[model samples]
Structures are given as structure tokens and as C-alpha cells.
Target: LVGSATVLCTDKTGTLTENRMALAQVWLPSGEALTLKHGQPVSKDCRKLIETAALASDPHPSDPMEVALHNARGTFAGSESSSTLPIHTYGLRPDLPAMSNIWDDDQALTICAKGAPEAIISLCRLSDDAAQKVLKAVEDMATRGIRVLAVATSTAPDRQWADSQLDYHYTLAGLVGLADPIRASVPDAITECRRAGIRVVMITGDYATTARSIASQAGIEEGEVLTGSDLEALDD
Candidate 1:
């Protein structure tokens, strides 16, 4: 099977980029973006965003993104909001492309959601022009060698309603741009694979631009990207 194999499909995380993740930038609902480098000042909007992330994040997360979120929350939110907890959680799934949490605040309910920009945009119920604008922003961020995740919010009268319906029709809040370093050895590995007569392909849940960026860095040949939506269309 080794020599006869014509194609090698691989994941992007450990296979391409180093699995270590860091918060690069954040685009808020107020149309403000803050880039976090060596420790930039956190604006009120950014603090709120971090607090939301803290509320939605796992206490002991093994995922890189979750660790980043919690670390960011600690940097900004501190210990005041550490007591907050989610009443309900919609865990990440392959089909959902997003995860959500509902919290009770002063007898009112608030929902915090984080996920792929495209997936969250669909649930936001925005106008055509607005959706396109956000989509454009997402694409722009991805092309800049950053992985983008959109944040959203929605309110229900109570937790029961929020739990009953998976789609709460959230409103777009902002986007977070994360950066993961590409492994130095990846390009050389790809070259050796090519020499062995194997056609390498990068298969990932990441957006096309992000995947393409890493592929280019790892010296993978340029090629068309087939997204999940594209694969679904072919099935139809």
C-alpha cells in the first residue's frame, strides 16, 4: 500500500503548523480592531470580548485555541469575572462549525458564541450587503496569515428557550485573528514526500486562504481548494 499510494491527505495542525496558538488581533462589533503583539492595551470592547471568551471557554482546556482564549481572558478580565459560568453549552461539532454557551446575568439570559466566520455569519441573519462586508473582512484577515473566528451574541427570555432551539439567530459581534507558527521542518518534509513519488494534499477544516497560506509556506504545490460546501454541492 505504501508504494502504490498515489495521494497523501494530511491534516494542517501538527502536520503543517506548530500546534502552538496565540492571539494575533481582534475585530470588535464597534468596527475597531486591536492587534496584540508584545502586550497592547485592551480597550473596553476588547475587554468585553475577552470576558465573553472567558465565560464560554473551558476551565481546563486541552485545545490550543481554548488555552489562548483563557490566557487572553486572564490578561484582561482578571479575577472579578472568574466566578461566571455557563448554564448551557453547545459543544463544537463537525457539522455545526461553532460552539455556544448561555449564561444567566441578573435574571436575564445572554448567549456567547464563537465559531468559523462563515458559519456564524449564516446564523447572524444579516442583510446581503452587511454579510458580504463581514465576509470580505474575514477573507482579508485569512489572507494576512491569520486564522479568524467570529463572535456572536443573542438573548432569550430564559435558558429553556435557548436550549430548545439550536438556532437562536445570533447577531455578529466581532472576529478574532489567531496566529500559529509554521513548522520549520515542514517544507523539507514535503520535498522528501514528493521525491518518494507521492502526491501530497492538505485536508483541513480551516478556510481555503489559511490552508493555502500554510501550504505555500510548507512548499506544497499550488492547487485548487475544495471546501466542505463545495464537496456538498458535488453530492447534490
Candidate 2:
């Protein structure tokens, strides 16, 4: 089968990338962007953003982005024990790609959420101008091959919990950019596949810009990107 194969289809994350993501950039609603470095101190607002993202993630996370958030939180803020435990959680759903966690502070209940920028932006219900600004930010990040996730916060009633995260009013805290570098062996492997007359194709759920960028790095030629919406609109 391998000898007869003419095309190879692949996923981006674990296939092309090392799958070890690192916190690389943060963009705030104020339009300020910060680049993070190892063993460096972060601004108070950036630290707060990292903390909130960590709160939104599971206490023990297996997902690459969640692990990156937790690692960033630990690097910037000494320990995770300083934060309060979550009282409730809204897991990611098919309809809503974001997940939110509610924590009870002494004064009130605090809600923190992190997920796809579009979903978080919708949850925050930003104005037309604000939403445009965020979409532009997401585009810039994606062009740089950064996987972006928007972070948000809100307050919940003391006695009542929302059945869905959308029920709460949320404020856009910021956007976190995670970088997953391409695997060292992928480029050479791709080149060899092409030499053998195999047509390589990459299929990913990532943004078009991101997919194109990674595809270029992995030595795959640029090609038409088909999104899920595009696929849905297509006919067999």
C-alpha cells in the first residue's frame, strides 16, 4: 500500500509540530502586545491574564494549550495554590467552543474563560469596532504561526449559576498566543516524500493563515485552504 500510495494527508499539531507549545505573545484589549521570554518578569496586567487563563483551564490539563497556560502561570506567578478553587465549570461544547470556570472569591463569584478567539469575542459581545480590532489581532497572530486563544472574565450571581457560559456578561481580558514549533525531522521527511512523487496535503482545524504558515515551514507547497464552513457548503 505504501509503495502504491501517491498522496499523503496529514494533521498539523502532533504531525508537523513538536506538540510542546509555549506562551509566546499576549495582546490586551487596550491594543498593547507583549512578547514573553523565559526567566523574565511580566507586567502586572500580563501576569493577571496568565493567571486568569490558568484558572479557566483544568487543574490538571493534558491539552497542549492548557499545559502552556499552566506553565506560564507557574513561571510568572510562583504557584497555582494561590488561586481559589473553581465552584463551577462550563465545558467546551460543539455549539460553543469556549470553556469557562467560576470561582468564588470572598467578595463575589469570578468567571474566567478561554477558547477560540471568535467564540470568546462573541461571549464578550464586543462592539463592532472592538470586534474588528480583535479579529485583526487574531489575524496578525495567525500569520506569525501562533495559535491564539482569547481570554475573558465576568462576575456571576452568588446563588445562581448559569446553565451556559453565554448567560453571563463577559469582558474581554486579552488574547494569548501559543507557539508550537515545527518538528525538526518534518521538512526532510516531506522533501523525501516529494522526491518519491507523493503529493503531500495538510488538513488542520487551525486558521487559514496558521495552516499556510506551518505548511510552508514543513516544506509543503502553498495550496488552497478549505475550512470547515467551506466543506459544509460543498457537495459530494
Candidate 3:
């Protein structure tokens, strides 16, 4: 297959990137955003955002994003514990694309959710203006090659869990942007492929701007980016 192939299609995360995710930026609904530097103290709001995201994620996480959340929580919020386990969990679904966890906190149920920005925004039921502001923030982060996730929190009724995550009323906490640095060898490898007369194509679920930025870093030629919506509008 390698000898016969004239084109190579690759996923961006884990393939081109080191897969070691790092918390880089935070955007809040108050229109406050901050870019973080290593070994620097994060703002209180950013620390709260990371803590909430960590609560929403699995305690023993294997996914890169969840791992990053845990790491960030430790770095920003210190080694504090949740103390109580989650009473209920709403798993990520194709239709909603977000997940929520309900925890028993001092006889009250606290819900935390994190996932795709669109899903969380919908869950928060933000006004048109607020939603637009969030979308703009998402775009700005994506343009910088940051993978963004929306974070939210809610209060749940005792012993009455919803069948779906959508039933709860959530407040948008903030957005977290994770950075996955490209692998060191990718650019030279891509150049070698070009010299060998092969075309390199990046396939990712990331935003078009993010894909374009990573492609440029990896030495892939600038070309048309077809998103899911764009593909749906095309004829097969």
C-alpha cells in the first residue's frame, strides 16, 4: 500500500501532535480571556474553570483532553479532592456531543459538564448575543491552533436525575483551550514525502483554522478545507 500510494491521509491529534495536551488559555462568559504560561499563576477564574472541567471528567482519565484537565486542576487548584463520588453521569452522545456529572456535595447535587463548545452553549441556553460572543472566542482560540472545550455547571434536584443532560439548566462557566504541540519530526517527514512525490492530507475534527495552522506547521500545502457541514452540502 505504501509503495502504491500517491497520497497520505492522516489524523492531526496523536499523529502530528505529541498527544501531550497542555492547558493554554481560558475564556469566560464575562468576556475575560487569558493566555497561560508555564509555571505562572493562573487567575482565580481560570482555576475554577479547570477545577470544574476536572470534576466533569473521569477521575481516571485516558483521553488526552481529560488527562490535560486533571493535570491543569492539579497545577492550578492544587491537590484538593472532590471528597464525594458522582451520583450520576450523562455520557457524551452523538446528538448532544457533551457529558455531565452530578456529584453529591454536602447534601446538594452539583452538576458539571464539559464538551464541544456548541453543545455546552446550547445546554447553557445563552442569549443570541452571548452565544455569538462565545463563538467569536472559539474562533480566536482555534485560529491560534488551540483545541477548545466549553465548561458549564448546574444544580440538580436530589434523587431526581434527568434521562438526558439537556433536561438540566446549566450556566456557562467558561471555555478551556488545550494545546497539543506538533511532533518534532513532522515537518521534515512531510518535506521528505513531498520530495518523494506524495501528497499529504490532514484529516481532523478540529476547526478549519486549526487544521490550516497545523498543516502549515507540518509543511502541508495550503488547500481547500472541507468541514463536515461543507461535505454535507456536497454531492458524493
Candidate 4:
């Protein structure tokens, strides 16, 4: 943390949530990993949702959808070499042995994932209690038509060696929904900037429709908005 304090702003893509997301949190307490090719679960609720996130998603294992987000977040943070990538210094592959780009202990829950809220929620296999919680989260986010990503991760130890890459089964972490998700570290830095007395603002390249939708989710009041051209004219 820094010694300054001021308003902080950030994006909501991966910065607030895990890069690799899951729809459901079916914990194999038996110490077994649950693997699904798609969201093909016997349970109606679980199967339906998981299928959607996997199928509807535009991200491949490693590609632009992920990189474009990282690139944009880098610019926001003013990170060096971010013209290529911001907070992430090296090449990142979500499935490989890597820690998340976003690692903030404080306000972990507030971290959000944005893509398709409906698609993200479908991947979860919920118990009665867990289902209610997920549903509440989904409803709260959806009513605003905010794009949400159900953030979930399965953890294994660093040294745990396995014969197959598929040895580990994912554990359900939590659901992080972002109207317009940023890189995972964006929230952390934004929070830090606020604590350290810096100004945080959002300027986007998207059309007004999507840009405003996501901005609202990032906590801007729904009213006047400005575009890139607007800035150019002001300079005149």
C-alpha cells in the first residue's frame, strides 16, 4: 500500500477475478477431481450453465480475447511494455502452472469477471444452499444486465506432481461477475492507488452502448459520458 489517498478507478475483466473461470463449484470432498468435457452434468441446472460458458466463450486456451484484455489493462495501469501487455510481464497461459495476474488479499470478493453473466452462471453445480447463493448473485447482477463471469478455481499444491496434466480436478472457488471485467490486478492497483492518493478514471474505446453498460458496472453513475473524439475536440 502507498501513503496517499484519492479516488480510484479500474476495469473489471480479469483484474477482479481469476483468468480461468468455472461455472459450478462441485467439490469432490472425497479428494477426487471432477472432470467434464463440456458442461455435461446429470443435474439439469449444473449441466445447462456449464455448457453455455464453455460453448459461448470466444477465448481459446491462449489468444487475443485474453491478450486484448491484458493489453488494455496494461495501458490503464501505465505499466511498461503494456503496449504488448501490462501487469503480466511474461507470456501467460491460464492452464499452465501460473499464479493469477491479480493477487490482492484485500477485497478479494469484490473482484469481478465479465463476459456473459448468463453463460457463466450455467457452469455451476450447486447444492440447495449454494444454488441459492449463486442465484442471488446472478439475479443481483443480471437485473442490471451486467455481464458476469462465474469465477471459480480448483487449487492444487505447487509441488504436487502428476503423471497426467488432467490429474487435477478443479475446485469451485467463487463467482465473480463484472459488467466489463479488466485484468485481475487492475482492482488491486486501483485499490492501492486510492490508499496512496491517486486519481483513477476510465476511458474506453468501445461504442457508447457497451462502454456505458460496463462503466456503470465499474461504479460510474449512469448519466453523461465522453468519447475519444470528445477529448480531441476539447484540446482544440
| Residue 143 error, candidate 4, Å | 11
| Alpha-carbon local distance difference test for all models | 0.78, 0.90, 0.89, 0.37
Model 4 lDDT, residue 141, Cα: 46
The residue-by-residue lDDT of candidate 4 on 58-115, one tens digit each, is: 2232543444333322322223221211111112134332222212223331111223
What is the total number of backbone clashes in candidate 2? 0
Q: lDDT by residue for model 1 over 15-54, one digit each (tens)?
A: 6889888878888766677888655678777877776765
* Model 3 TM: 0.94
Best by TM-score: 2
Error of 3 at 56 (Å): 0.8
Candidate 3 per-residue C-alpha lDDT over 1-236 given as tens digits, one digit per residue, 9 for 90 to 100:
78888999999999999999989899988888988876788778778888999999987789999988888888876755456678889999989989998887677788999999999999999999999999999999998889999999998776578888889999999999999999999999999999999999999998788788889988899999999989899987
**Model 4 lDDT, residue 91, Cα:** 21
Candidate 3 stretches with Cα past 4 Å from truth are: 80-83
Q: Which sequence of candidate numbers ranks them by lDDT, best first?
A: 2, 3, 1, 4
* Model 2 lDDT per residue over 36-79, tens place: 88988878888899889999999778998999999999897556
Between prediction 1 and prediction 2, which has the larger lDDT? Answer: 2
lDDT of 2 at 173: 91
> Is candidate 2 or 3 superior in lDDT?
2
